[model samples]
Target: MEKTWWKESVVYQVYPRSFMDSNGDGIGDLKGILLKLDYLQELGVDVIWLSPVYKSPNDDNGYDISDYQSIMTEFGTMDDFNRLLSAVHERGMKIMMDLVVNHTSDEHPWFLASRSSVDDPKRDYYIWRPGKDGKEPNNWESVFKGSAWKYDEGTDEYYLHLFSQKQPDLNWENPQLREEIYSMMKWWLDKGVDGFRMDVINFLSKDQRYMDGNILDGKQHGDGSPYFLNGPRIHEFLQEVNQRVLSDYDVMTVGEMPGVSPDDAVLYTGEDRGELHMVFQFEHMDIGGGPEGKWNNEKWDLSDLKGILSKWQYRLEEVGWNSLYWNNHDQPRVVSRFGDDGEYRVESAKMLAACLHMLKGTPYIYQGEELGMTNIAFESIEEYRDIETMNSYEELVNTYGWPKEKMMAAIHARSRDNARTPMQWNDGRNAGFTTGTPWIGVNANYPEINAEKAYNDHQSIFHFYKKLIQLRKQHDIIVYGRFDLLCPDDEQIFAYTRTLGEEKVLVLCNFKGQEATLTIPTELHSLKATLLIGNYEQEESDTVSSEPLRPYECRVYLLK
Candidate 1:
């Protein structure tokens, strides 16, 4: 495997909207991020991945960019953004910004011009076609569960949008558009930002034929796969993107590749791929999909989750690298999603951290993952602000006319709203996120889940995360070490070892909320090991005789 800084370091993602609010505007801003540098330094994260803070209409919660070079007014000015870059670099940490080029907001100048007239020079900048018999041009479905084409009366054409109608898909086939994106990327690279986390990068290219998708349940009948995800000429576009911009800098590039498979992951991030440093595959993250990408309360067994995770880990170890994540701004927090947040909140959080961090990959700790945050409970759908969730609910209730109760149940289980809540800074009003009303509601339990409370508690999830990152840095075995799964037969237990030269580190965890035991494999049984860091201190008996792990107990042992 190639030796890159990203291959050995841990990254933490911070949703700027929830990280902190400096101006009391109920929005997290760049100034608020500057104030939290010390806190991040304490957590020992090497990279702070900021979600898009670009000038936007915020139709997709800031993913819809109106201007590429400017910062959103709600986020502060470009000057504040530069100051944030300085603050992060000064603290010996790298900063990564979102690269959301799959589409731009309809309000963007490019889109506005494209929609002006059919024969306009900029009309081809976006995908637009004359309506078919006065209707949508193509039978494609939007990812949010509706028609992908929207009629523009003035232009006498329908534009394609894989997401919200306000966020029109960018035509990557245009060489000028490609150059512009690359130029903007180089500008950021020159500005000293460390890297980029691309949004839906696989969807950048689409089939030129505009073929129809397969009809499923009377929805738009077209091959959505061809129209979107890993479309024709995607790698060519990405390789060009890399050569002109990404390859010029030694920064990490993690693409949010939703439709990529394990084999495709190799192609996207392999040593010879020359495309991306890493890419996120939703195999593990998409365990429970509601009706058309929604979240549901469907029971997910631990074994299935472990198997999916192991498949990616083992496959990437041989092909490319994996971007390990338990939470992000688009998904619910890890602790609340996988671990028991009610009774074993702290222990389960720390245990889950230890379990995943020891694996051979670049672990990404989303903001508040270190504090073991739980899901938010919104009072009504009207209170939600995320465009994706709102559109989905509308599709179910308005277009399809599904039962409202059924939709609400799914929303509770899977809404992006769970992750979009403001950061819980303290038990103070508005969770100390903002002095004014928050753009989104705060998790009501913020008082108990704030950073202050966790930072002070020695056994808090925050401190455990610190130890986890430091261990990866201090020990070579944890970084480039080869991974081997042990005792794979045990459904409730997940265990693995990393072997670097002669150094060996073993990690064992009880994923479920019940105590479980697994016999040490022969290779590990005879090895003399010392407890390095654990969620709980080892009892005399546990040290003297390797005992079975209790519920949510995770420990790492270094070979002596």
Candidate 2:
């Protein structure tokens, strides 16, 4: 396999609003991130994927950007951002800024002009269509709920918004708009920023002929994703972006692409494609969901999870690279979703980390993940802050007439707010995140799962993660090794091997709370195996045994 800086480096994602608060204004800011540079450096991450910090109206917590070049006032001024950038580079770490060009806040100047009138100069900058038979242009559903098209009374037309109504989709077909986006990207690169984490980049190129989608769940609108996601000319636009701006810089770019397949991923991230370094696909995240979508409560199958991950690892091995991650700002904590978040929280968290980090890809660690943070169970719907969750609740309860208890159960399991809670810095007030009241309520378990406690404990999840990061740096096989799944059908164990040249390593992880036995295959039973690292205390053994492994145990064995 080819070698690259991003390929061998570990990327840490920081949701700025939940990381830390310096001035006690109840929100995390650039200054607060500047204060935690040492913390990140000590954790041994090479690249920091900072979530959107651009100027916004806070309609979607900074995703709905209003200004491309300016920093949000809540996050601090442009000078503060410059200082943060300098500090990060000084510490020998790169920063990947969130690029949210697929859509912009309605408050943005371009969108403001586009929505003014039909003959406005910037009217074509956004996707606008006339109503169809006194209804919306098409029966498309917004990701957050309701109609995707919002009627603009001023222009007597409808504007497309895949997300919240406040976010208007940009017209990628317009060369002028594309140029503006490229100019903004160049400005940041020239200002010493590393690269970008393109948000919903696949949604940029949409099908020109708007059409109604097949209705699902008996809703008034249907999922219009098929007409927009990975639409025609996506590659052309991305290649243009690479040629005009990205190719000129020595930076990394990872596109957040939902509903992308493995074959299509190759075209996006292939070494010679010049589109992206890698893409974050959501197939793994949607493992346990049913036909009703993410909110449906369905039991996750370990075998299915293993199959999806293994398929991606193998398919992308030669052509493209993978961006391995379990938790992000948009998803629930991995420990809570897939592992035992109660009794075996620490053990399962380590196991999940080991399983992901040992894969043949670049690993991303979200904020608060190292401390084994679990999902929060808000008692009341009013306590939820995420627009997606709140909107879903209203629709499910009021429109669908679903029981409040059922909706609340789904909200507790799938809400983005589960991951947006304040970072547990210490056991003090507000989990030591801020002196003032937090924008969202802190998890009630923060007293037991805060970073301070983990840092003080030698055997805490934080230290285990530190060791994993160190091991990745020490062993090149972990980065570029060829992956092979051992037991593809095991329901309680996830086992795989990484081979690079003559070096070979086997990783075994127990996914459940009960002890499971994994017998060594006769093909390699005679090989000497040295325990490299594990979650539990165990002496280095030079031979493979048939003994049963402990619950949630993770072991890495180097074979000779």
**Residue-pair clashes per candidate, as listed?**
6, 0
- Across residues 447-481, which tens digit of lDDT does each residue of candidate 2 receive? 99998899899899998899999999899999999
TM-score of each prediction: 0.97, 0.99
- Under the 3 Å rule for N, CA and C atoms, how many clashes does model 1 have? 6
Candidate 1, residue 485: Cα displacement in angstroms equals 1.9
Candidate 1 CA-lDDT value: 0.85
| Per-residue C-alpha lDDT of model 1 across residues 385-424, encoded as one tens digit per residue | 8777888788777877778888777776678878878888
- Please report the TM-score between candidate 1 and the true structure: 0.97
RMSD (Cα, Å) of candidate 2? 0.9
